[model samples]
Target: MENLEKAIAEIKQALPGLTLLEQEPLAAHCSFRIGGPARALAVPQDVSSLARICSILKEHQLAPFLLGNGTNILFPDEGLQELFLISTEKLQKLFLLPDGAIYAEAGVSLSRLASFAQQNGLQGLEFASGIPGSVGGGVFINAGAYGGELKDVIESVVCLYAPDQGLYELSKEQCAFSYRKSYFSTHGGCMILSAVFRLQPGDREEIAAKMRELNEKRRAKQPLELPSAGSTFKRPEGHFAGALIEQAGLKGFTVGGAQVSEKHAGFVVNVGGATSHDVYDLMLHVRKTVYENSGVVLEPEVIILAPDYKLEDKGPRVHGNIVTVNGPAEE
Candidate 1:
């Protein structure tokens, strides 16, 4: 707490132009519209500014909790008083290289990135047109839908290694992408700066048509009208989570404001006034019932943020005011 206080003071003096929100409401910033005030949320305009903020936090022995579009995370209603947050909201630099690869900052929404690709007559990213996450978050979780993931197109990633205060560009293979997981997600201490995507050239109208088709399918099946994270649980090996959940008779199950979506069994929607605890309890119940019925354990896809309410399978997580970045989580 003392170190966070010191870092906060130093950051104010060092980067006056940066937008620093002290005790900012997390609900106002996330898609789920949940969570209480964060201790501090810093929005950097570009990569260098973000790096500078990380540096200051690291000096204080703090590790920042990186927030993207907040589509796949659950924050506690009690608020994160000791955590320092870094938002990729303003890191919006995106363009194409002369060699035809697309370069994007962490903050670029996946939908926008897909649209940009379609506009340039690029194919392959059509499946991402409906995913509601930024490039950084998408890359972090290898966000996928309709048979496509960010990993399929991403060629490289440039990130800030917090431990050394240096930058490293990792190749696609080095990223070690897999089913909703990545090097960045499993390994801590590295902050994604930007990424390069390689795509195949295709007819513009054809690309747009494919994107439209995928988005239409997504809208028809998923609960776009509700406030919720995308998927509540990862697909248990060889079995679909939604099907298993529905077969367990948990369809439309509710705990307070949180309910399993009747529209799609995979999603847990906030009908209204849902607290983080509401979602958490509902998920726990779902996990319990589903396991009891199906003999398959479900793992939460949503990143729950609360010291006391951590999932049993939780790994190296950075809580508190000290922002430590990639140490050994690096490789």
Candidate 2:
């Protein structure tokens, strides 16, 4: 406790405008609303502040986790310890360039980007209308949805990296984007500052109509009424996670407060007061039962940031291009 407080104080001196909170609840930040309190959390007001805070944490050997919209993570019940949570919620800056390009800051949400594109008569980004995450997080995980992915529109990304010194620009090809992966994820030391996307001119009404169509589909098919970390697992080769769960007859399966969504068998929703352990246990059960029943194994799509009660069976994750993972397009 004393160490965390001292860290917070030191961070405040380094970053004046940024706000620091001790023992901040992770559940409040996550969409699932399941995680326990973090040791400390810092919300930087802008890019400069964020960089400064990062530098401070690194200097103190207290490297923290970068938290975005919290749409794709499940924190543990015992909570994170001796770690700092840095939020970019306040760094939202969206603008249109004179060269028909859209420059968006990392903190901007996909939903916001979709709206901006539609309003400006931009044809692309229609598939990302309902993706609930920030640009950095989306790009970090290569978020995609409705047949469109981030690599489709992203021309280049400007990142704050300290390989030599300060931030630098990396082209689309340099990003090394792949199926739900990126260079920033592979090679550390790069913090996404912003991105420039090339968009085609189109009718505003047409773009709006497309956005509405996708949003409607998401509402109808997904369990929007419940809280979940999007899809529970990635689509394995020649198989779908939802279908596997359904075939296993584990739809609506419950573990404590966590229950698989009957609306969409792929999702494990928090019906009421679900704990992190409950969700983790249920996920493990789904993987075990599905593998036992069938030859295929399921891999988790949602990232876990805390310790689990038991270790997940570690083996080769089923990988191939036999299926598509539906998600919001990346920036």
Candidate 3:
């Protein structure tokens, strides 16, 4: 407790202007709307401010979690007492380059990016129109939908590598994007600052039409009305996770307020007042049941976090008829 207080005090002293929220409720930040209060949360206004905050956290040996819009993560019900959260939501900046590319900060929402692309008459970003995450989170998990992905249009990414506290630019290839995976997944220390997306000139009307079409599809299939992380499981190899769950007779399955959406088996929605433990237990049940029904193991796509949480064994754990696959699925 003393160390935590010291760290918080030092952070405020170093970055006087940085926005600080003490004992901030994390549920207010995440899309799932389920989580306890965080010890301290920092919202950096810009990239330079984010860098300074990161440096200070590092100097204090405090490893903060970098949050981007919080659309695809699950915060523990017990809350994060030790880890300070740094939200990039305020770092939003977007513009079109004269050469027909879009430059966006990590905090820029995918929706905004898609709109910006349409405004500039740029194509190739229509697929991300309804994605609820910020650009940084999108690139982190190589977010994709409607047959388009960040890897398809990204030219380069500006990252703040935490090891040296230095900024570096990585080309699209260097991003190591592959099937909802990226270099950021393995290297948790690096922070994405901004990205330059290479897009082609196209008809604005056509782009709008495409976005509308995709959004309609999303609305029809997804349980958008409920509070839930977008997709609960990654598309398993050669099989869709949703289909597998449906086949396993797990649709509409409930564990407290958390339930596998009958509207979309791929999603686990919080009906009302769901706790993080509810969601986590439901995920474990889904994975185990799906694995038992079919030989294939299902892995969670939602980024789950708690201060003392540790990755369990990846191999199947047999308990009665349920077989749990503890490995991470593709984002």
Candidate 4:
């Protein structure tokens, strides 16, 4: 605690005008609305401020967690006391280039980005219209919906690589984007600053129609009214996580305030006042049940941030692969 206080003091001196809060509740930052308090939370106003804050933390030998919109993360009930939490919420600068490409800061929401593209007659980002995360977080995990993903439109990224406290521009191929994974996922201590998206010109009416269609599909299928970290588990190879849970008869299963969404088996929602422990326990139970029934171990899609948290399963366990279900999996 003494070291933390000293570091905070140094940060305040180094970066004036930066928003700093002590013992801020994580629930207020995350979409799930369930977590304990963070020791210290810092909000950077822009890329330069973010870089300065990162440098200060590095100088003090402190590793601060870079938080985006916090849509797909689970913070522990005990809270984040070990690391300073840095949020990109205020760094939301966006503009369009003359060449028809869009440039957006990390903190810009995906929905806003898509809307911006639509307003300018750019077509490719319609799939992101309903995603509830910042551009940085979306790109970090290759966030996608309705068959389109961040990799599809990303032209380049400006990132603050923490190892050297240097900024570097990485091309699309360099991002190494795959299904719900990216270079950021494997590389620790790197912060995404902004990204340039190369989108093609299209009719404004057509783009808006597409976005509206996708949003309706999302609203129809997802439990948007409830608080969730979106999908609980990644889609297992050759199967969907929701279908597996449904097949295993685990839909609507509850552990404390956390319950599998009856409306959509893919989500584990905080019915009301759910704790991180409850969500974690429910996730474990769901995984075990699905594995026991189908012989395929489901991997979590949600990023769980808890002290000493580790996956109980070593990896996916496939036992004598065979058809366990009668028909094709449902979305």
| Model 2, C-alpha of 199: deviation from truth (Å) | 1.5
Model 3 segments more than 4 A misplaced: 1-3, 309-331
Residues 277-307, candidate 1: write the lDDT tens digits.
8988888788888888988888778877766
The lDDT of each candidate is 0.86, 0.80, 0.84, 0.85
Leading candidate by lDDT: 1
On residues 148-229, what C-alpha lDDT tens digit does candidate 3 reach at each position? Answer: 8999999999999876898999999999998777887756677899999999989999999999999999999999999998
Which lDDT tens digits does candidate 2 get at residues 1-331?
4555676788877667668776778889998998888877888888888787767655555545667899988887777766677887887999999898999998899999989988888988998879998898888778898889888889999887643337888899999998777887656557788998888899999999899999999999999999999988887888888999999999999999999899999999999899987887788788888998887778777877654333535334322111111112112
- TM-scores, each model vs. reference: 0.94, 0.90, 0.93, 0.93
Off by over 4 Å in 1: 310-331
lDDT of 4 by residue, 236-322 (tens): 889999999999999899999999999999999999999988998898888788888999888777877755444445233322111
Cα error of candidate 1 at position 187, Å: 0.6
Q: Model 4, which residues run further than 4 Å from truth?
A: 310-331
The TM-score that candidate 4 achieves is 0.93
lDDT of 1 at 83: 84
Candidate with more favorable, higher TM-score: 1 or 4:
1
Give the lDDT ranking, best first: 1, 4, 3, 2
Ten contiguous residues with the weakest lDDT in model 3: 318-327
- Per-residue lDDT of 292 in model 2: 87
